[model samples]
Every structure is written in C-alpha cells, then in structure tokens.
Target chain A: MTDPDEAADRRLDANAAAGPLAELFTVDLTVAVATCAGCGNDAPLAAHLLYADAPALVVRCPNCAGVVLRYASSGSTLRLDLTGARLLTVTLAADGSVGISERQPHRPP
Target chain B: MSFVSRGFAGRRRKTPPGRLPPGQYDVGDGFPVLSAGPTPRTALASWDFQVQGQVDGVRRWSRTQFQGLPRESVSVDLHCVTSWSKFDTRWEGVSVDTLLADVVTAAEFAVAFSDGGYTTNLPLADLTGGQAWVVDTYDGQPLEPEHGGPARLLVPHLYFWKSAKWVRGLTLTLEDEPGFWETFGYHNYGDPWREQRYAGD
Candidate 1:
C-alpha cells in the first residue's frame, strides 16, 4: 500500500544506497531521475528515501512512499526491481551533467 | 558480510563480545527503527489476529482475547539482515504455540502478514514449539508503533525481518510461497547463524 501522505525519514536518503548501486550499475543510479509510478513525482534518486535495514536496498519515492527501486544480491546472483518507477531519465555526458536525452524503460504507459 | 560503502556513517554500531553472531555489530542501547514502509497505527480495538489457510477453520482473536491468553517473558538476541544485532532484549507476548494449540493444521509452511502489507515466509516448524511469539510489549513497556506496537511476530532465531512488525496474522500454506522480501532475494529461511541474509546464501 503506497501512502501519499507518508512522512519521509529525515535521517536516510539515496546517498546511503548510492555506493552499492554504483557497484551494481557501474554508474551512480542515485544520479538518475526516477518518476514515481504511484504519483508521477519526478525526482532524482538522490531525493528518495533509503530503507537500509530491509532485505533489499529499498529506495522509495519521497513524495508517495512508493518503492521506486529494490536492489538485492545473494552471492553471485543480483536482482533489481524497477516496477515502481514509471520512468528513469539518465544523462551520460562526460561532465555527468545536462540531460542530452532521456531513456525510459521500453514499457507502455 | 554486508555491502557497506566506504565511510559508511552508521552510528553507535560498536563491536560487542562473543555473544554476537557472525558479521554483526551490536547496536547497544539504541533500538534502531528501520522499516520498508510507514509505521502503521492500528488501534487496539480494531486489531485482531487470525490463524487461517490450510487450517480446519480460521481462528480469530480480538485484542482483549489475545491479551488474555497465556503470556511469557522472553530475553533474546535480535539479528538484522542489515548486519546489526541487539543482545538480550526483553519482550512479553503470547507464544505461537499457544495461539495454534486449539487450531488443527497439517500445513508445512507459514506466511506471517502484517498491518502495513508486509509478509514473510517461514517453515511451520520455525513458528511452532516455543521458538516464536506475537509480542506486544518490549522492555516491559507497551510496544511503540515504530517498533511494531499492538503486536509483532518475534522469531528470535531468524534474522529480524522474519519478525514482521505490526503483525496481524499467519496463514498456513502447503506451498512454500515466498513473501515480500523473500520474493525480492532474501533468504527464504533466514537463519542468522548461517548468515542467510540473501536468497542464495
């Protein structure tokens, strides 16, 4: 159940998950902009809340408390769930700034 | 071992003595509050626990009825999948054994579900005997909502996620269906001693 009125925890943010996600994607996933499927709130993953103690690294939208990403690893197996993210726009400029183009998942809206 | 980044700024995680499990640091005196969702505020009047699925009949208990059941005090260690453990914490609650005593069931697996739509899978054996409880009090005080008030499942032997917070009920199942975290790659049977934090571990 996604609660739009959920209060975000002040102590934790996407930076807590940035390191592990960087290891997984080799690029900083927190730098990408994720649009929340629950409420269409567009924010950088850095603005999301990290639920650090879960079995997976759960990144939830700050606006709706809906999970935006779930990353988990067990030994050699790694899984990433982006079901809650409606769109992810990544900018891969050499300076790592400026959105030249946006890459959303190939799923219909 | 946990996948901690460089300069991980987690606080108060000091290394405790031999009482700790592998890859775990003690969060002494600090009861860490970590949840996948917002803390649910279920009032005691509306709160009820049920034992259903694969049972002969669903057994329901109102809050007053559950509180009236046989209660026991427990002192146990809690190991989180996040690689932190708290030692010798005290809790009071009705045992799962006592709750299931009158219910007839031949199910082999169980899924403990909570108020905020969280669920975790467990072998029925892990939930039976004196191993688990539906704890309502912690350190002799009514459990705080952040710490899963009203009642929460306490399976001290497994990693803390198996101890579902704001727990509402258990469903016995013939199939070993993975619940919430288990479907997401957490070890189905989270035995902290074996370091079963993830699925393939």
Candidate 2:
C-alpha cells in the first residue's frame, strides 16, 4: 500500500494556494509575515501548509499546525478569518512600506 | 478577473447533481490526502482512544475495546476547504453518539486531539445526533495513517478539516477552545453552506 504521509506532502503550501486571494489583497499574502496566536511562532505565510480542497482556503502554521488564516468567497461576499494570527506584517513594496494588521477575536454575527 | 492557468482550464467539468458545493469542484475518484505533518505510525496494540476534559471523567478504550463498540457503515460527501469535493465516500466506524453514550457531560464544545498534535474544535451539538464518528476504515479497508488510520474524527457536514485526522480522543470543554486550525484563522463554526471559512465569517 502507498504511504499516506507521502500523499499528504504532495499537497500545496500557502504560496501555491494563495492564487485566489491574490486578487483580494494589495500585497502578496504568500510573502507576508504571520505570527501564530497559539504558539507565537513567526514565519512567512508561504511557509504555512495550505489545504485548498473545499470552499475556503485553510492555511495552517508550519511549526505547530495551528490555523493561520482562512478565506472563503461567495459571489460578491468574501469572508476572512484570522482569529489564530496575532499579527500579519506585509511589505507593501520593495521600497519597504510595511503594513501590519492585527487579528481580532471573532464576534458572533 | 480570476486568473486561470492554461493547465487548470481543462480540469473543471460539468457539475454533478448535488455532489458539488459552492466554490468547490469534483475530484473524481481517489481521496486526496492532506496533513500538517508526517504521518504517525501507531501500533494497534498501543493505540487507544479517550474522552477527557469537562466530562465527568475520562473514558478510555484500547484498540480492541474500541473495535468492540457498535460499528456502522456511512456514505457521505466530503468537501475540503481547498475547493475539492468527493461524493459518496464510504466509511465504517463508531459514532460519536455511541462513544459519548456512557459518558456524562454538560460541555458545549469539544477539542479533538490527535496523535501528531493535530487538533480541531467543534460544538458538542455537532458531535451528537448522528452527526459525527470516529472512523477506522474507508471503503472496507483499514484507514491509512495519512488519512487518519487507527481512527479519525468524521464530521461530514462542515469542511473536511473539521473532521480531524489521526484523532485519538476528545476533550470536552465548557468554554470554546480553538484547536489547531481554528486558532490560526479558520472559521470556528465552519458551516460550508454559509461559506464561513475565516474568523469573521
């Protein structure tokens, strides 16, 4: 029988999975730095493992496997959940105009 | 405005009836494996499942004991958050309802902890009422480790991520504690129909 673990590694990372969200953000999400809220681990979004087999994009922390972010789109409505991220730092340009966004706990809708 | 690579253009086909969900495509045959870490090899002799946390007390079952629990065969569609949906996948396992039948608890939520430290949270309500299972087999064969062999949680209603792989035991809690993916950015209440993929959604 084929090793299932090998099959899992065949999956894509956040960088490859970010194709859809590339249009929603001004900066490249793959290049952005993300700090995990759970373990406080820091890494580029590209380093996160991305499972993009469903309706939403699921990005998990490479260090702890905690979720770093999730995004879903339905027609004109888009939902982004970053509850597990402490902060996301994006370098807007090569010139280094940095943008930092803090993730807040989700409120009941 | 979506960019479609020349290679990806031909991958999509006509949607099948009631099989495809919004923002997802059919990946006909063969289950696609996705995991956060290397697959763990747990010997069946040492494998055990537990129910801990806010429950009256922890309940444990060895590989033999778990298999002794009543089992059922289930056929359901699996929708991954990454845009792939597989229809009519079949599995056999013990239902969460049966697993919790003897345990007593007032907890409103659960955190499913797995062998390789993978965790995912779910409302207690979602685990009951025939909504979920701890499956050990897929299509009459023992589930492969990468697909959460020995046992894995199966919550078919939400995205597949919510159905944690390599599951060992569940920790019931009075307060909602976000598990692995939930802590990062995945929606806490991952309802596929609502497309609640992120924190705010």
- Per-model DockQ against the true two-chain complex: 0.32, 0.16
Per-model TM-score, in order, reads: 0.77, 0.67
Candidate 1 residues lying further than 4 Å off, grouped into runs, are A1-8, A11-20, A26-49, A53-55, A61-64, A72-78, A86-109, B1-18
lDDT, candidate 2, B81-167, per-residue tens? 766888888999999999899888989999999987778999999999999999999999999887889889999999889998889
| Stretch of 10 with least lDDT, candidate 2 chain B | B7-16
Candidate 1 lDDT, B110-201, residue by residue in tens: 99999877899999999988999999999999998889988999999999999999999999999998988887878889888898887667
Candidate 2 residue-wise lDDT at A82: 90
lDDT per residue for candidate 2 within A1-109, as digits (tens), equals: 1746546555456777557776688666776778999999888887777767534576778777777787767657766889879999776545565443432222111
The digit string of per-residue lDDT tens for model 1 on A1-109 reads: 1433344332366767777876578666766889999999998887787777656778888887788889877566778989889999877877765443452332101
The prediction achieving the highest DockQ against the true structure is: 1
Scored against the native two-chain complex, candidate 1 gets a DockQ of 0.32
Candidate 2 RMSD computed on C-alpha atoms after optimal superposition onto the true structure: 8.3
- RMSD to the true structure for each prediction, in A, is 7.1, 8.3
